[model samples]
Target: MLRYVTVSKNSLHDITLVALIHDIKFNLIKLLQ
Candidate 1:
């Protein structure tokens, strides 16, 4: 149960990081345009 919780937390962190990176990329593209 602890392991599962850790894995879920890691997955959530990765997803948040990906979302942040995507947002930065989108903003950069908008700025370029």
Candidate 2:
């Protein structure tokens, strides 16, 4: 699909990726507590 290709083109932007990873890490830490 075009959307898939487009996202691949930009890799969802560095800022978006950072935020996503950060959110995941936060959730994981929260779970540990």
Candidate 3:
């Protein structure tokens, strides 16, 4: 159970990081245009 919780938390963190990166890239592209 503890391992599962830890894995889920890690996955959430990674997802959030990816989302943030994607948002930044999108904003940059818009600025360039």
TM-score of 1: 0.98
On lDDT, the stronger of 1 and 2 is: 1
List the lowest-lDDT window of 10 residues for candidate 3: 1-10
lDDT tens digits, residue span 1-30, model 1: 999999999999999999999999999999
Write model 2 residue lDDT over 1-33, tens digit each, in one string: 999998776876866989999999999999999
State the lDDT at 9 in candidate 2.
69
lDDT of 3 by residue, 1-33 (tens): 999999999999999999999999999999999
What overall lDDT, based on C-alpha atoms, would model 1 receive against the true structure?
A: 1.00
TM-score of 3: 0.96
Error of 3 at 32 (Å): 0.3
Off by over 4 Å in 3: none
For residue 31, model 3's alpha carbon misses the true position, in angstroms, by 0.3
Instruction: Name the regions of candidate 1 deviating beyond 4 angstroms.
Output: none
* Each model's lDDT: 1.00, 0.89, 1.00
